[model samples]
Structure formats: structure tokens, C-alpha cells
Target: MTVRGPNLRLEGSTFGPRKISAWREAVAPFWDVEIRKEDSSEFRGRSDVYHLGNAIIGLTAASELRNERSRSLVARMGVDHVAAQIRLEGHATVEIAGREVPMAPGDISLLDLAQPLSLRSSGYRAMTVIIPRALFPEAGTRLGAAHGTVLRGATPYGMLVNNHLRSLAAHVPHFTPAEARAAGQATAILISGAAGLGVESAAERPLQRAPVFLAIRSHIDAEIASADLSVEQICRRFGVSRSGLYRLFAPLGGVAEYIRRRRLARACRDLVEGGDRAARISEIAYRYGYGSPAGFTTAFRAEFGLSPADVKAGARPDGASAVRRAPTDLPGGGWDDFYEWVLTLDA
Candidate 1:
């Protein structure tokens, strides 16, 4: 059955025996999932997913699942999202990069979507946060090698993040679009913190540069509305060399491109989903640090392939039109419906 707000809740009973294949197809966008049972029998599962503006949060309960690296699923899927899986019940093991990490209830681990892995879970329940790689540029290398690295959920940071995820999953439906967007940003920050990439004192600094990069990103998000926000300013604030800053943001198409893309994304959300319908295009552009309305319009059209006016006039951008037009009438059931619901959350 459907839940209120922008969510998709599904149960394996809806599709009965087909749940096995449905599960496979549902995750095909992110992984080539397979169900493995001791005996050849039907599989059953359930999941609830919340479409935060920039991240996808899911609470899932399922029977056993198995993925072997020999299957070469990573090559087949070419996934680009990272899954932070937090266990709520049962146990699971993930083998990645020749290391095996097992999770008990309350433990969490990060899985690199692009890497080959073998994961097996018993009858299990979990909360998963799937984040786009572009959002966490600092964590790129760590995440790439984070296959079996487990974060102890009993730790203070892990507990805080776990509770936050639980609360976000429960309250996401009631959040206004702006709140959802804010929550998505908060989610990224929390995940980074949980992974030991938060701002650190000199004595606590790790060898990796992830913490520094995370701090830089947090600052950029905070000052995005300022016209003077620039790489030079970031360098001054972070005490990083221009070359070092450029190297950090290289994967994200360089720092300036990242800032422009983020600002435009927020502008698009404001144009289509903001509560203040009376807000003008120029006002929206100015709010995101665009100095000129013409420049904003040109950049907006180029990035989204639609004029800001078109979006403000209720013309949805490309694939987004379907969700805005019919949020409730998504076709199919089980995993297919879940997959469609997930796609609507894309920015």
C-alpha cells in the first residue's frame, strides 16, 4: 500500500513468488541482485523508500540475498551510487577487494557501487542511504575501498547517524520540499561525519584528505548564496593551496562547475517546488548567487535543457514531467513500482 507524501512502500506478498525476480529487477538500476536460498523456494521481502531531494533513504526487510563477484555484476550494472547499509536485524557479510566484513545487528558498512562484491544476508532488516558519488567528492577514494569496512553503530557518531536515519525515514513524508532538500544536505554531512571525515583538530587529523574536503564542501553549501563565493575564497578559508583545491574537486568537474551545478539545482527546485509562487525568476536566480537574470536563464537552460520560465510555467524538465503529472498513478507493483518511485527522486 502507498504511504502519504513522496514515498513508495511495498511488500513481497504483493507479488508472492515473483518477489525473487522482482527484487532482482528492482535493484538492477544499482546492482545485479540475486536471491539465494538453501532450497529452491520462493522469496519474500518488503521495503519503504523515501525520496529526499538529493538522496534516497530506504528501510528494507528481506529474505536471503547473494551476490558473487564472479557474476561480474559491477561490470554489467556500472552503478555510480554508494550504499551505506545499517543493519537492524540478523547478520550479513560483504566480501569486497579480498576482505570480508561481517555485520551484526546495529553495525553499519559502506559499499562502493562500482566495485565487485559478494554479499550474503540471512533473513534481515536494514536501513540504507543511497547517495550519489558526486555529492561526496572527498570520500571518493575511501568509498571506493570501503567495501567491508564496518562502522560500529554503538559509537557516538554512529548512533547519532543511525538515529537520524530512522527519524528521517519516519518524518520525510511530512517535510516540505525545501525541508527535504535541507535534510538531504544534512544527510550527506552526517554520513561524512559517521565515516570519520568530519572537521578535525590537528591532533585528531587522519592521513587522508577527506576531512579537509568535507569541510570545504560544507562551507561551499553554506555560502552558495554569496556572489563573492569563489575558489580563492575557499582557499583562503581552508588554508589549502589552489592546486590542492583543484585536485580535490577534479572528480566533480572542478570546483566552479560543482558550485554552478549545485546553485542551478537549487534554483530549479525553487522555480518548480517553492511555496512562494509569487517569487520571480530574477529573484530566484539572485537567491542562488546569479548576478544577472540573463546569465542565470542561459545557464539554467543549458544545464536542464529547459528555460527557467518553462519550468516556472509548469513545464517539467525531460523525465521529470511524468512524476509531477502523476505521482500517484505509477504503473506496476513490487520492485518495478519501487524502481519507478526511486527514479522520480533524481535531480
Candidate 2:
């Protein structure tokens, strides 16, 4: 199988007002791009976008500019999707409903297309994944209110998502149709989990415990290295009753199950990457709070369907080849494809 991508490509590399006009034409569907008259001479921009039938991913970079989706524009185009972005090289401020959200490099943010927002940025590069609202109906009310929410890249959840989005963008081309669809669904689920960090909408009033729920997850992730990490300690630290904690984690298989999965997940990464130091199997187990090598091995294989030694030897649990890239005969979608991809995504 050959790898192919970048279904839609847009770039303006020349000096002139018309070049800027062309750039705006490319971005007109999703956002209105604005650049000062004189600054047009120095303007440069480019975006390569891909479609996976279930999601749209884009890699974009442009000179300093302002982008907006007015309330009128929101009504004109009824695209209901959520865009999750990771800033790669520059910073910006997103203004939504009069509130300003400052974005920095490595930070991830969510934007609900149904809502209007304006973003002003210095020349920047970014990677974005756009998912249809239909897939996340569970978070609809919460997500509609999550516009302009930011997840700091320094946080545990943020780092995991940050790395996954980047890796997913690069690996999309090699994905088979089935693999791409599965990945798209998995990406949507992963993002909904992270959406817990998003701002809750007062109008929805559905996420009463969202903040506390997010805090507990963060605390668990930070303390995963300690074998003694337990529900009793968590309750004391967060000042929540044991039943409250259980209720918060019920959707994720309870707190203890969450912690166990997290520990094994971290250990699996260590085995696969081998990091700066190739730790022994027993050491990896102990480092992740596993009591014995045998126990860790059994748990890891049960969760991932692969043994620790298999992972160390470079066997991917997902069955995708590690380094597979070749030119493919993929459709080179013209400008119209961008509009079609976002507007009729589920089709």
C-alpha cells in the first residue's frame, strides 16, 4: 500500500493584493482572512488539508493576520463541527462572545464552528483536527459552550493529546480506509475525554461536576508513579466522599480501574520507546507501580493483546507498520473538496 495525502492545497507566495485575495478565497469557506493593505506585499500563507471520511485534518502556516467568523457568517454556513488545534510556532488570542482566550505555542484549543469567534495571530504554524458534531452528541451541550477553551500543553492530558494529534496527522496518509475510519472514531473519543477541561456552558447546565471531575483525573495521572496511590488518599486530598469519587469515575470504569489502566499504559509506552535508557522489564514494571514483572506482563498483554517483550521488540499493537511511506494514487481534490469535506462530513 502507498501513502497519499494533502487532498486540498492552498498557498500564496507572490507579492501583490491579488495574491492575498486568492489566499482569502482559499480560506473563505471556514474563516474570513484579513490583512492590512500595505502588509499584503509581505503576506505569505499555505495550508494542506486531508479528509478521512470521518474527520478533516489540516496543516497550516501564515503571516500575521486576523481571522473571523461573524454571527452573520455563522448563520450563513451551518457547519457544526469542533476544531481542536495545537499551536506549533506562534501565539494568538481568540475572542469569543467578548471574552479573550490567549494561545501560546504547544497549547491546544477547541473551537465550535456553530459559534462565532475571531482570532488575531502573529505569523504562526499549527495542526488542526476537525470532527463532526454528530459524533460527539454526548458532549454537544458541553462542547457548544466550550468555544475558546484552552488546555495547557504542560498538563498530563494535554501532553498526551498534543503528541497524538501530531502523530496522527503524519500517519494519516499510510492508513487504509478501515484504519483511517477506526482512527477517526478513536480520535473523536479521545478528544471528548479531554473536553472535560473545556468551559462548561451555563445555558446547558449539564456538566455540574466537570471541574471537579477533571481535577481528579489530573491528580490521578500525576500520582500514577506511586504504588500506594488509592481512593482513600484521593478522597482526603480532594475532600470528596468515597461515593462522590466513584460516581465521577463510573463512566471510565471506576477510579481504581482508571489508575490501573493509566499505569499499564505508561509502562507500555516505556517498553515500546525504550526512551533514553532501555530499562529492564522488571524495572519498567516497578517504575509504573507494578509489584512484580510477572504481574505487569500479564496485565499488559491482557490490556493490549501483546506481551511486554513483544512491545520491546517493536511489535505495534495496532498492527500498523512503523515506517511505511510510498507515493499513492489518491484523488487530488480541488478547491471545492474543502467545502464538501466540512459541510457533508458524515455523507
Off by over 4 Å in 1: 1-6, 12-16, 37-42, 67-72, 137-142, 197-347
Q: RMSD in angstroms, all models?
A: 11.3, 19.5
Query: Could you estimate the TM-score for every candidate?
Result: 0.55, 0.61
Worst 10-residue lDDT window, candidate 1:
198-207
Per-residue alpha-carbon lDDT of model 1 for 1-347, expressed as tens digits? 23244366666455345776666555554554666454226567787776665677788888777755332333223235667778899898877534576778887777655445667888899988877665664644455434445776787777887788778777877776668767877776666555554321111112146557656766776787788799999999999998889776654456776677767766766676653454899998888877789999998888778899888887765223122321443222344444344433343
- Tens-place lDDT digits, model 2, residues 1-347: 42366777887457567767777766676887779877878888888887776888889998899988765344334466888889998998887656677888988888877556788889999998889866764744456546677877878888888888888888988887777777778888777777767442212322246556556765776787886689999999999999888876653456777777767766765675564466999998888877899999998888778898888877855311222222123446566456556656762
After TM-score superposition, what is the CA distance of residue 140 in candidate 2 from its true location, in Å? 3.5
Candidate 2 global lDDT: 0.72
**Winning model by TM-score:** 2
Error of 1 at 164 (Å): 1.1
Clashing pairs in 2: none
TM-score of candidate 2 to 2 decimals: 0.61
